[model samples]
Structure formats: structure tokens, C-alpha cells
Target chain A: MALELLKERWSSAINVLKVGAVKEEGGTRASAITVGGQTTLPFLLDEGGMPHRPVVAMEIFDVAPLEWPVSLLEPFGDAVKDPVKWAKKCINEFKADLICLTLKGTHPEAENISADKAVELVKNMLKEISTPLIIIGSGDKEKDNDVLARCSQATKGENCLFGLAAQDNFKTLVASCMADDHCIIADSPIDINIAKQVNILITDMGFKPEKIAMHPSTAALGYGMEYVYSIMERSRLAAFVGDKMLAMPFIIFVGQEAWKVKEAAANVADEPGWGDERMRGPLWEAATAVAMLHAGADILVMRHPEAVATVKRSIDSMMKGNND
Target chain B: MLVIGELINGMYQNVEQAIKTKNRSIIHKLAKEQLEAGADMLDINAGPHGADPKETMRWLIETIREVTPAPLAIDSTKLDVVELGLKLAGEGSMINSTKADDEKLDIYVPLAKKYKAKLIGLTMDKKGVPRDKNVKCELAAKILAKCMEMDLPLEDVYIDPIVLPVNVAQAQCAELLDVLREFKLISDPPPQTVVGLSNVSQGTKQRSLINRTYLVMAVASGLSGAIVDPLDKELMDAMITAELLLNKNIYCDSYIDAYRKR
Candidate 1:
């Protein structure tokens, strides 16, 4: 029997952001990633059509030391000491589709690496890995811009994700990425209006929509993650249901957040029979990533090799379902 | 503007009777007429109306999906009901609601992900209905934050700032318009701003007139879509006029054709 169909319409569509650089002559990486290509809401392939499935990118830090949950830190114990080695482990062992390098040491209190040091770390990661890279600053707006500026210049042609373009200080960050012709993370402080506003700001700066990835922000599972999930789902639905302006592919900072929560960080000793922190932590991250995937997250920034593998397997299964 | 026909809800006595009888014909007729009248989607709401809402919602969504392609808006405050409805419906569906409240967000958002459906977010949180438009905006921001966390694309969200009764508060319409405008200004990929469209007409004389007038104003204030009676020619006409005035629809060569044909 033929299933009757319902026509869906939109109030306003959310813009979709593309993930990678195309097989262009511009970036230094072998290729770029693209997400958020929807003519209809996410997963409405039969109703309208989905041009791209969300992608998964692994997370790597420039100077990995201190503050990482032990579960994540233990897996790559020695590799955690070396950025290049860690990047290799992520791609080779973890099968990461892409690598996101967070310049944590560039902050005021951390190692406080100079702009040149930041660039060197990024350059090292790029040399060590073939997948596309996403470069983020350590949350310090000024320091972020400085390091991102140099990193963007240094990784010119690689199409890396430069410093997150926050509302207040996106000017320098955006400028740096533009100068080196790199992709950027249009980061917002968990507000849909601000996310759209930032996109408008970035586009107004003449940056292409396809070149930007909006991290609307992610919340760990068991910690308001569902709220984040719903908002992202709604945004994607509006865009695909018929709001072309917001139809850009979206990315999620899953690992950074998922790992921060007690469910993913604390041990059984701390929580009492919550199971092994080693397995539980990665599962928490994987579960969070998987849930977000269904909600239309195009790029997932994850940590822990096992979590990455688990998410990849799930994506493979989902794609198979989509294909059938 | 997309009008999601506001029928098939258990809140309405007729729909409740129809559901109890398992009257496929009544449900089919309701579905067919609304689709013909240009309802982009049919909102299948089976709220707790003194029966098993979950069971009733499941049946309604299944029965409705069997008849129409205008994707189902799984309307219910119950998670089990929404989950059942979403599973029973086809792709590209929308969950009728989750509110701005953190607890509500926690429940409804997971269901959205589980079902992979778009959702209608009510601006009223645990704090009750906010009288201030800025507060509504803040509520919307919180809702949007949840969307990001979920990785559900912002475009899939349809924000419905809780519409107060105009009879109770004459300035409600103006306040709603301000909230809707602020809603339009959210994120790079902003969620769709929608309203119940008839809530303001409650207790008013000449309901159709009041409803249509309020709808036009709402649309003018950046309301991209609404849940309304597509059967009402006046209401539909207001939509066309609103879209044209908003410049969302082109009037260049098809002005007469569009107006007369409608």
C-alpha cells in the first residue's frame, strides 16, 4: 500500500554551513569537508532531499597537558605528549575523518605559547595528518586572534577552521582566516539569534556561507544536551523544510563537552558502580555524538579513539539505512 | 506562509469523539479537506483529553499518515505519545512542542532526536508566560541553546512565543509582535517563528476578523508561519497579503493572478 504523504512548509529556514573545502586548489589540505546541504529538513530525504549527511571530525589539542579527563588522557598517554604523534594516532588508530586542533596553551595561564608557536603546532599537525584540520583558540579572545591569525597564515591553503568567530572579537579572527583563505568556526555562546547574527556578520564580511561552520554550542549528555539537540534539530528542520538562508551544514563540539560531564569523566568509585570510567567515558561521548548525529549535526568534534570508532560505526550503520 | 491546519486535536470535542469511534472516514475527511484547502502540514494533536493520550496519539498519527503527505506535526505534551507518533509517521515530521523550560527541553528534545523530527518550541518556560518581549527573547535564546546542544539544525525549530489573551491584556498583541520580531533576529540559521494564530482571537467578537487581523500583523512582524484554519478564505487571504507585503512573495507579474486565483 502506498503511504500517503504530507506537505511540510517552513516559517523561516535556518542556514546550513558546509564543513570541508572542496577539491580546490586553494587549501593546503588534500581536500575539504562540506556539510549542511539540505533542500528539506534533516532526514527528510524522501520528502525533499538531503544532499549531504553530517560528517564526523576527531578532536586534537595543540599542547595536550593538564585538564583532560583521565579516561581520554590514558588512551594516548605518550601520544598526548606530542601533537604530531597524537594526530597520527587519531587518524590511524581512531580512523578520524578530520582533526580539530584546540590551541589550549595559547591562553594567558597555560603554556601561553606565542603566535609563532601556535602556528608551528598547527603546521606540525598538518604535516603529521592527511585529514582536514579545525584550529581553535583557548577561549581568550585577544590571544586567540593573535595565534589564529598566525596559524591561519601558516596553514594557508589547508582550509583549516581558524579561531572561532565569536560575536565580540570575530573581526580579527575572521580577518586572519580570510587573509590565509581558511575556513572558520562561526562560534556563538549558545544562542540561536547570536548564531544567526554571527553568520550574518561573517557573510556580511564577504565570507562565503559554505566556508563557515557554526558551533551553536553543545551540552554534555545528562546535562542539558537534549535542549541543544532540540534547537539544532529545529534549525535544520526549518532550513530543509524551506528556509534556504540557514541551510548550511552544522558542526558539533561533542567531545569537548561530552567529556566534561560527570557521566563521561567521573569514575565508578566517584559515582558508585557506574561502571568502568574507561569504557563508560567513551560510551558517554559516543552516545552524545550519536544522538547529535540524528539531530543533524554535520561535523562532530570528538575525543577518545574508542568513541570516535564507535561513532564512525554508528554513522556507517545510519548511512546504510539511508542508502536502503 | 505555511498554514498547518489546527484540527485533529483531542482538545476539540469532535476530534475526541472521532478518535474514540476509530472513525477512519472522519479522520480521512479531516485530513483530505485540510490538505486540499492548502494546509502545508496537518497538526495531529491528541493531548490528554481524559483518555490514554499515548494510545490515541499513536492511532491518530498512524491513521493520519496513512492519508496525507503534508508531514505530521506530532502534537502532545506526553513523551510517550510523541515517541509513538514519530515512529509511526514518515520522515520530515515535526513534534508539536517542547517548551522553553529546562525540564521540558530535556524531555522533548530527546524525543525529537529519537524520532528525527522538527519541533515547535513554546517560549513559556517554568517561569510561566513572560510579559516582557525581552524575556521572551531570552526564553528563545535558551531554547536555541538547547537546539545547538542537540545538534538539531536551528532551521527545524519553529518558535511559538506564548500568545496571551487579548481580552485579558489589550497590549498582548503588541508584545507578541515584539517577541516575534526578536525571534526573527536569532542565530545565523534562525529557527522559524510561528504562532497558534487563533489564540489571540479567544473571547473576541468576529473571531475570523480578529484572527485574520492579528495573523496579518504577526506575519508583518516577521512571523514566517502559523497554525491556522486554512479553510477560512479570509485567513488565507491575509496570509497571501502578508507575504506579499513582507516581500517574501513576488507581486511583479503574478499579482492579479495570485490574488484572484486565491
Candidate 2:
């Protein structure tokens, strides 16, 4: 009866695809990440149903990232210099459910690293971090295809999420995902049409539909955040009804994009009387992540240990079964 | 002004039976009721009911066409069902689903072009339903791409992201409004945003009340057409109110006229 009631209340519990085959089931990875499967938007316990708590992935960089604003520097001081150390700090200190390692340095311009160099870093990341890992590109389309393809093979049995499958190059990423039996981040710009187009393109390649964790694009709060939030929310709605094709779980790069902006990372005198940069920055990231969660973001690729902690607490509290 | 009469669907068992029996009497009655209730087109769905969907669809379409000149909305998941129904519809028919899936378009675009029929594209693709509004729009664009590729006119592409249930998916309503706003801005001629309004109230109490309220909001958010029952008085009233609020009707005057006619 409770199950029936839950089903009735949550008319459309969005289907969350569970990626990776466990050794218990067939593959590696100690456990798997379950995204989607939400009956309501974030934190509406009384009205709708909540399924699979939102998963938080702490961001790790391939190389010591130079562009991280100084305000964010203090938290990961020495760890920033070492990718494995950064993943350790993210898992142990930050208590991240998953770790997202951005292959930002693999960009032809970022670090100009070879595919072997990229593979070595991923090998170290997989060895160092026990949590599920998501490997992202350096935001360069062509470089990502070549590098992520190599990373996919390097992390073959790990069920990692290769951090992008764009509309133009999803075919290559899909092939890599198929070969590696891994998941992909179906990332698109802020347009809903582009996001769906990418997903359609990926599936059209004969890849497993559940393996695609669509990134509907995230915008920092002050800078067109509402637009991004609204788009994510609408995509969730389309999934529930009779539309079978669009029912996949969604991924949001909650921390990386939302936190890097000046509004989120700016310190004292930077924005004049804008409080403590430390508190303000994580809060901005958390707020953005929370808003996207409400907009039906299943997986949040976040940064900032404190922000990750806060967002996890919120998810836990929101998911405490509305039967109360 | 393009009111797609979403009556006569298999979701309701009576209609399902009527379609199965090829009961011209019941089918004819429903069609005339919708026409009288100001429906511009009548949507016919045999759905997943335990009936020969194709035959039921053909029967429903043929019977409705014989009774009223209202254009047909060939509603079905099966591409062939839509194709067969379109062939049966003769002219000025509307295909109910061309999903964001390119495979669907592989079938729908050609059928639509061949029949010169208007097509409704469900804003979902091969990966299935998207939970984000942007993805829905992206799906719409993908479907539009297939339409454009086939030289199908943009005006004939009616996009339905398929409205989310509000009580269950609370943020869904707000998200849909956002999608509607973006859809208005991004679409070339802006393929019309149609919705199955009844689904919004599927599991809720005072469903008519919820559906009517949402209908007002949806229409205001540039919903060009809706797959809604023309028979529900409350829904009809909400549509009139929405038209007035949007000034699609010049004042409350049209509302009064519509109400009086009813």
C-alpha cells in the first residue's frame, strides 16, 4: 500500500539509469552510482516521492590547475599539485560519494599532454580513488574525443563516466563507451534542443540508452542560471509521460561551472562588502547545485569540499521519506 | 486557435471499446460533440488497448471523417499505425507523433511529406524522456531537423514535450513554462507547443481543477495547441480564461460569447 501510495503521489518517478556492472553483477567498481529515479523535484518530500539520493562527485584535475581562483586555492593547497592526493583528499576529507577527474590538461593547449600521459594520470586516479570516477575533457571538442577514447580504454573495467559526448562527436565517445562498457556524460550547451540532439545522436549510434547521463548545461546563478534550471526541469517532465525516448537520467556540472564564476569565488574587496569569500563561494556552489537538483539533476559534478558536504546533507534531509 | 480535440483516446475504456466495435454511433457522437465544443481537429488514438490498433484506428478515422469534416490527429506509438491512419485520413490530417528519435523521423517525415500532413513531434528522442527543459527543446530541434531535412514545412511541425504531472513533479510546471518561453524565442516559425493536458492531472484529486488551472498557465505560456478533451467544461472554461488573459481574446468579451454558446 505504501508503495502504491508512493507511486500514486509520484506519478512520474523519473527513471534513473544505474551505470556499471558490479563484480557481484559482472564488472568492477566497488559499487555503482544510481541517478534519476526521482518522483518529485528536489526536496519536496511531502508532495512527491524521492528516489536514489543525489550523488555528489568531487572534482579532481588531471594537472595542477592554474586557473582555479585564489579564493578556492586555500582548501586544497598542496593537494592541488598532485592529482592522486587531490582524489584522496576529495574522498577522505570531503566525503564525496564519487570523484570527477577533469582531463583539462590534456587539451592541446592546456598541458599538451599525450594520450599516454592522459592514460597514466587516469591509471593513477583509478588506483588512488576507490569511489566511482568521472573523467571529463578539457572542454575542447576534438581533443576530448581522442583523449577520452584513450582514457576509456585505460579505465576499461571501472565503469567511469567519460565527461563528454557532444552533438558533433558523440559517435566516437559512444564507441569508446561501448568498447569500455563505461557510461558517458551527454553534455550540451544551455539549449534543450542541443541536449536532446546529443542524446539522440548518441543512441542513434546503437549505444545503450541508460549509459548516457545527459548534462543539460549549467549556468552560474547570477548569469542566466534560471534559464539552465528551467531547461533541466522541463527535460525531467518530458521523461515521465509516454515519451519513452527521453527518459534517461540527467547529469549537471554543478560545481565546476557554477563555482568558477566571480560571483561565486570572488573575495573581500573583490565585490565590496560581499561577506567572506570562503563561506560565500561554497554557498553559491551549494545554492546552484540545490536549485539544479530541484530542477531534476540526478548527478551533480561538484567542487569545494564544504559545498559537497553541505549538498549531501541537504539531499539526505530532503530524502528522509515524506511518510512523516 | 488550433484546438486539437484530444477526445476518443483508448486511455478511456469506453472509447477503446467503441473503436474495437467500429461502433460508428459512439464514434460519430464523440466526434460531433468535439466539433460542437469548438475543436479544430479530432485526435484519434487506439493506444495499447487489447484491440487491433490499426483496424480500430482506421475505423475511428473513417467514421469520424464521415460524420464531421474536422481534420484527424492520427495518434499512436506505432509509426505504421500513424501511416495507415494518414492514408485513411485522405487530406489535411495531422500525424500525432514524430519523436525526437531520428528513427521515428525516418518513418514519420516521409509519411507526412507523402500525405502533406501536419505532424506532432514528441519532444523526446532515442535516449528516451529528458528531465530537463533544454533537452526537450533539443529533442524538438532534432525532430525539426528531420522535418527540415525532408523539406517538411516548419508550420507543420507541432512539438509536444508532453506536460509533466504537477503534484508529483512540482517543479515540472515551472520548467514547462520556461521551455515554452524558450520555444517561442528559438523556433523559426516556432513549431507550435502542444501538450496532453489531461496527463497533468492523471493521479491527482480534483483533477479537473488542477488540469484547468494548468491549462490557463500553459496557454499563457504560448501553448499553440493542446491535445485536450473538448467535453470537459472546466477545462474549456480555463482555455477561454487563458485566451482572455493572453489577449488572444480581446477582453473577457470572447469568454462570455464562448460560455453563452456552450
Candidate 3:
């Protein structure tokens, strides 16, 4: 008897979306990042094609972080005091594929930075680095609607990927992206149906389906990571099985979720048996990111340079197909 | 659930008059309304009154295609009329039905294969509707066997156990539901099950209530598709809720609105 192999072919594929634009395309970035365009499960090369490998976007905040632990902040040094230097280090030394700048200062509870100030910071960051950018607003819904819209206009031709478009507050951001020719990140809390509904709502507002990426929400490695993993797996399965509305590529904030968890944030004295705080912290973030890649994350927004390097190696190995 | 819109048939006075007078507006309006109401596919039928049923089907298909690219179900009992519709309907369309009889299967199965359309096999023959669940299952088994022999994919084959009106044949309604459950066990990849949902409420006073209840019951029994009036908002709501309960769709406060938009 001969050995038999079973392979399932899918009827549809994830829409391929390109983020950023170069000088010739009316953008200041050196190159655009392409994601999605997979017709099968992640790294199942024998069954179907995964044309673009998953990329990493290192996170930097517009305002200096007041809460980041010393272990996590040690690598960046004085760059942590300035957003432009932090973004430049992420692109030049950390070798990040893209820069994810969060406008935390614009939140009402924070510095309450004006939209004009946020736009000036974005312009300075763009001038400092040629890497594609992923700009997200502060968590406040009302504040984000105002700040993100202004940032979106300032970077009109840059074609940056904007973020956190929720079901209720997507209209302003969607209109901005439509006018400025940029991609969007749709946010959904761990529910597959809500993820789909958010995408539908954005598309209904005339946003092209191909240009939208999904953030199905994320969790730390030991803190309900399985929930985020399962939701993403189910979502990818739905896409492969021809659900057009659920077929956008996934964007996960591995660093934001992982670093907040105590396992990654606790000091060595707090838990002696868990190994060194510095090693455990970055490893925890890296592990969460790698796990997300297996669950079909097209782009991972991570913190910590060490964790980013570790995840980049994993992505390289996974992109080598089944030969290894 | 696959909601096949059943409003385009010439059996309806408006549709019949439109077909006789070649009024594209009425047919076009029905087609658009059914689709907007969340019909996965439209069922096209030329009733007995049309002198040239083939011509009527062509016109109906052409009129619908001009408006939307949604898939059509070429529905008719006549083989020639169905063949004509299939030829003009393009791909992703379905043959409304063929019987469980071998002679009908021998012709209709190949016709379906040739046209690359799905086949709906009714689990009844010259003996008419089966009297019990066991007999219906046997007929369904026969249809599955024929589909396998003809190399027609079972996934594309829909087995209808035939619904009986509640006002007349009340006892058979339960029997029909049982037959739908049994149909799943007939093959490794079971054939999809569908029913003309309106049949269960024929001549009943609370037609809408009976039809909605029976449709939900049928869905619980693994009925994958149905031919119903999509324009009935309450009926569509009940069907959507049934699917949500089955965990086919995730629950949200505006799940009904989300489903409609999808």
C-alpha cells in the first residue's frame, strides 16, 4: 500500500493589501509593506500559498512612557525621552520592518496634546525614518476621533496604516482613510462575529475591503492567550472557507498585551523561580508574537528590541517553507 | 442557511401577468427586493400558464442577470424547461429538482453534471410522497446512491424529504423532520437538505406562524437550505434567530442587522 496524503483546497483567499507608498507613488517612505494574500492556513506551503511573510512593527509612544518597567526600557536608553529618536532606533538599530507610533499624549487623561501637536510629531517622525508607519490614537474614543483624523490628513500621501477603528467610532477614521489613501486597522474584542461586523461596518462606509486589516484583540502568553489564538484560528478558517467579510489579514499587538501581564512585568524578586525578569519579559513577548504568527497574524506590533529580534528569526525560519 | 427566494415564479398573478406582457419592471423589482431581503439565491420558475415556458425562463433569467449577479435556481418539473434554463443560467445555478426514480436520475444527474449546477433530488417517486420516515430515508438513500454512481458530488446534491401541509397531513410533518435527520447518515459527506417551507403551512389560517415554526424546527434537524418568501420580515427574523441559537453565527445586540447587511 502507498502512503496517502490529504490536502484541502480553499475556494477563496485573503485580500492582499499594501501599506505605505514610496516617492514615486506620492509617499515619503522608502518602501511599502504587503500583507495577506494567503489561500491556506499559515505555513501550510504544501497545501496552498502564503506569498508574503509576516512582518514586525516595533511600538513607540509619542509621549515618554511613565509606567514602563526598567527591564523593558533599558534597551532604548535616552531614546525613550523622545519619539523621533525612539522611532529612528527602531528602524536603524532594531531593524524593525515598520514603526508603530501610538499618540498616547493626546488622551484627555494624559498630556492632552492638541491634534496639531500630534501632527507635528508625526511629520518629525516621518522625516527621521523612511520605514512604513502604523499610527494609532490614544484609547479615548472622542479624543481619538479628533486626533487621528488630523494625523491622517497630515500624512495624506504617506499611506500609513491607521488603527483602532471600532464599531461605533469608525465613521470619521474611515472617511479620513478614504480621502487620504491609507489602510485601516479594524478593532474587535475577542469575538469572531464582532470582528466580522466591524469589517462590514467599515466597508459599508465605502472603505475598500482589501485595504482593511483586522485586530481581533490580543492576550499575554499565560493570560488567556488561548482565547485570542482560537479566535484568530477560527477567523482564518472562516476566511479560507470562503467567508469574504472575514477574509482580511490580521494585525495583533503582541507587545501591548504581553508586557501588561504580570508574568512579563514582574521583577525577579517578585517571582524568583520564573527566571530573570529581563530574559522572561522579552521571551514572554516573543513567545506570544510567534504564537500569533502561527494563528495567521500578518503583522505583529511588538515592544522590546530583544523580543522583536527573536520573533523576526522565527518568521524567517517559518517563511523557508517545508524544506527544513 | 441558504435562503432561496421563491418570488420570481410565474405562478404568482403579478409574475404571471409580467411574464405574459413581457414587463421587465415587475420581474426586476421582485428580483431586487428578494436579494435585498437576504436571499442567497433566487428560484426562477415559469408556471403552467406560459405558452412558451422556455422563452419565459430565458426572459426571467436575462432580466434578473441585468440587475444583480446573484446565483439563480433554475426551477421546473419539466426536463426541457430546466435544461434550457441551465444552459442560459451560467454557473453556480441549481436544478430546482429531479425525482428519486432511477430514470429521472439517469438524465437529470448528467444534465446537472454537464451544466455544472447543483441537483435537488426529491425523496419520492411515482408512488408519490412517502408515507413514513423509513420509506423517505430509503428514497433518500436511493438518491444518494445514484448521485454517487453518476460521480456527481454529494455536497452539491440536495435531498428534499418533501414537507406536508399541517392542516391536512399533520402526522407526516413529524415524520418528514425525522427523514431530514436520517438523510445525514446516508453518506460520509451527507447531502444538503432543503424544503419548500411554504408547503408546511398550506391553507392554514396562521400561515406565517406555522411556516416560521416549521422552518426553525427543520433547521434544528439539519436542514441546510430553504425556499421561502424572503420579503416576510418576521419569518426571516425567526430563521436568523434559529441559526444564531445553533451557534452558526455569533451573538451580538444587533446580530439581526449584521446578518441582513451580510
Candidate 4:
């Protein structure tokens, strides 16, 4: 008969997945980052436990340059040419929680670089940075299958997070991650069914479900970002209520989606309605990353340091009452 | 869970008024709400409203069909009323009930076969519900046998062990689980099991708690369908969690959301 007495009893808790490795664990990272062990919705420590905070991973391209919008490139400066330095700068300067080494050059159409080149870059970045590593392959399906597999093997014992595996191209990457004791990023189109099916398929391949991270294809804020938000939200809700298949930590390509959108890079001169170009781009990225985080993104792959700092502060302060 | 939404019945003021006034909008609105809340089927009952039961069934069917062609469970003790609703309903339907009496099964089985409608056979016979699990199972097998003899596929038969109000029949609660499990062994292609879930908490203070707890336990006992209120958020949440624990559904973080989307 009373409102306060109406407390609900949630039956199942989300399964937690720990990514990254440390020295004792046979890797060089400063610490392991664990996510997805929430007993309630994000930061609802009132309802249940949120074992891990949303982590921010500063993305560094292996090849760099050529295509980054000036607003984005302005922050990194000379570090653009070398990945090892770029990754180191993200950790040492921005205090990035993790380093996501994007093997952009390995895409067949981009530089047509060989898998050997990507492996070398991964090794160098791992050596240069103390933060946990998350390696992302270029979007090309066939090329990513080869590049991610080889890179996964090259850093075999590091317990890194490596993937971007689609429904058709997951086997090689899944096998590599399974064999190497690394985590996976099971990427699906912006659809729940496909996202769930992909996770099932990856697990069906004998890979443990907890070692997977979801990349339910997202879009930037102005460019249909709500679809990504809903998909991720749904995935998390399912996980909280006891769906182990979709219970993996979510890894959103915030930087990738945010930077590619026209609004993030559009110049004020081109569209006078948009105020300053410098502030617009980073703010756009920050806004998108923040949205993804609240929508149950466990790890964010972000670009701008200012945006990274903003999102990190947002994550830190968001869990204020939870006693994280 | 085959949620047969308990709305769209004349028992509620809105639906009673809708049935009396033939207000298609109100019936359609409830139908949509139930479906949105993840009901697999809608139960069309011309509850205590002031109208001819047959005409009320026809009107309810027309109102529901106007918006969506969702499956319906024609709920009424009157066989003719259920038959009329089943005839007017656009798609598949489940006859809300028939007791395990041979006379009732003889009539209901032929009607079910002729209309291709599924039947919900209660495990209570002329003597009323027996508290014993074997007694309940025997009645269920009697109904299952009649359906088999009539060549009505066993899959189309859903056996309800007739849940008793826990406040009075608390002793029957444990036997309910035993009866459900034994029903699976009654026939090959095993008749699906169902329950009028809310009946378990008929006069109980913790109605929602009792309904969901009993539903989850019944699910563990292989209950395939339940006549439940789709709008009961906590009840639905508990059922979703139960399926996940049973490993019937692949686990997802947003399981309730994903289940709702489905």
C-alpha cells in the first residue's frame, strides 16, 4: 500500500569482463581494466553494483596523417607521424586510461600495408605505453581478418583487447584472440538481432562469451546516434536481466564515428551558422562520447584529448553517490 | 512466455464501458498497450458488462482486428460465447477453457479440430479440483487422450492444472509443480502446459510477488504459457529473468529491452 516499500528484486547480474594485462599477469600494462559487472543500470549504485567505471581509450593511428581534420590534428602536433610517440603522449600528457591502437594503414584500400607492418606497430605501441591496449582493425572485412589475426598473435601474451569482427569476418580474429588469451570486440551493424547473433556465433566458435566486447555500430550525435544509443542500452538491459550472450562490455567507436561526421569537422567559413571550428569539432566528439557512455558503453575509443578529458571527468563525476 | 494480456476484458471499467458503448477506440487502445508491453496474445473476454455475450464477443473481435491481427484467447465458461469469439477473431485463437469432464472434452475437442483453434484444458473435473498431483495429472491425461482420439494434434492442447488461491490452498502449491512436470509424460509430442497465473494469488496481499514467484517456479517446471497481465512491469521483469536463468534465452545485458523489442 506504500510507495517506498515497493522495491524490486532483480534476479540476475551482468557478467563482468576484465580486459588488459599487468606485469604479474604477464603483460606490461599498469593495470587491468574491468567492465560490465553491473547489477543495475549504469551508475545506479542505489539499485546495484557498478564494478567498473566507463574507461576512456585515446586512439592513435598506426600510419596517421593524410586524412585527420585540422581541428583534430592540432592537439597531437608532431606526434602524428609516429604511433609510439602518439600513444605515449596520450598516456603521459592526457592521463588516458587506456590506449587504443587503430591499425588504419592495414586497410586494403588505404595504404595496402601488410599484416607484418601492423604487428610491428602494435608491439612498438605496447612497449611505449603503460596503459591497457585496445587494438582496432580498419573497417575493411578481408584485410581486417588478416591484419587483426596477425597483430593478435604478435602481442599474444599481452591480454590486449583486439577486434572489430563482423558477422562474416569474425572467425580468424576470434580464433586469434581465443588462441592468444586476448579479448574480442564483436561488432555488429546498428541492429540488436544481428548484434546478439554475432555474439552467439563468436561464443559458438568455442570462444568464452566474457572475453567479448560489443561494438554495436554507432553514429555521431547529429548523424543517427540515438540508434546506437538504443542498441547499446538494450544490450546492457538484456545483460543486466541475465542475457550472457549480450552481457559483454560495450566498446563504442566514438572517435571513429564522431570524427567522420560532417558536423564534427565542418568549417565555420563553410557553414557560418556553426560558430568556431576548433571548439565545434572537439565538443561534437565529447557530446557523442558522453552519450555513448551513459547508454552503457564500457570502453570508448576517442580522438581529441580535450574531448577525452571532458568524457573522463564526466565518467568520474557521474558515479558520485555510488562510492566508486 | 506466451503472455495472454488480461486487459480487453469487460471486468475493467474502461472495457465494460467500451463493450456497453461499442467504443472501438478504448478496446483498440488496450490491445495496443498489451502488445507494446510484450503480450504474445490478447484474451478477448466480454466480462461482467451489460450486453449479450455473443454480440460483445463480436464487437471485441471487430475492435481488436481494426488495429492489428493479433492472436486472441476467447475467455468465457460459455462454450458458445468462446466459439463465437473464435469464429470472429481474424487469426489463431485459444479457447479459454473446458473442464476435464468427458462431456466437455467431447464437445470442445471436435470444436477445436473443426476451427483449428487451440484449447486450454483445465485439470478439474465434475468433482472440482483435486489437491493430489496424481489426481490432477490423471485429469490432464484424460483431456489429452480425448484430443488424441479426436486426432487433434497434442501440441494444440494446453493443459492448465487449475491453480488454487495460495491463501486457502497453500498445501496444493507444491503439488502444482509435480502435476506440471508429470503432464509432459502424458503423451508424445507432449501437450504444452499453461496456467491462469494470477489465480495463485487470488486473495493474497503480495499478489505481484506471489504471481511472479509462482510463474518462475512453474516455468522451471516446464510451464509453456501463462495468462498474465502484461502491464505488470515487475512480474514481466521476473519472468524474463527466469527464462535467462533457465538458459531458455541467450543472456544479454539489456535482456528485458531485447525481449521487449522482440
For residues A175-272, could you state the per-residue lDDT of candidate 4 as single tens digits?
A: 99999999988888898777887887787788987888888887999899998888777767766655566777888888988989888898888989
The candidate 1 chain A region of ten consecutive residues with least summed lDDT is: A11-20
Better of 2 and 4 by DockQ: 4
Question: What does candidate 2's lDDT look like per residue over A1-324, in tens digits?
Answer: 355444324345566677545677545667787877666656666666556777888887877877777767778989999989988988888888888888888788767788889898888776666677888888788887888899898778778888778766678878998998888888778876667666666766777777778887788778788998887766666554323345567788877787668888777776878888888998899888888777877888888888888888887766775323
Once superposed on the true structure, which residue ranges of model 4 sit more than 4 Å away at CA? A1-8, A322-324, B1-262
Better by lDDT, candidate 3 or 1: 3
How far off is each candidate at the interface, as Cα RMSD in Å?
12.2, 16.2, 3.1, 8.0
Among these predictions, the greatest DockQ belongs to 3
Worst 10 residues of 3 chain B by lDDT: B249-258
lDDT (10s digit) by residue, model 1, range A213-309: 7777898889888888777765565454343334556778998888878878998888887989999999999999988887778889888889888
Question: Which regions of candidate 2 are displaced past 4 Å?
Answer: A1-13, A46-48, A321-324, B1-262
**Predictions' DockQ, in order:** 0.02, 0.02, 0.28, 0.06
Candidate 4 lDDT over B178-251, as tens digits, reads: 88888888877677988889889998899999999999999999999999988899999999889879976755
Model 1 has an lDDT value of: 0.76
Per-residue lDDT, model 1, residue A270, is 84
The DockQ-based order of candidates, best leading, equals 3, 4, 2, 1
Can you write out model 3's per-residue Cα lDDT over A17-130, one digit (the tens) per residue? Answer: 899999999999989999999988999988899999899999999888969988999999999899999988988999999999999989999999999999999998999899
Flag the better candidate by lDDT, 1 or 4. 4
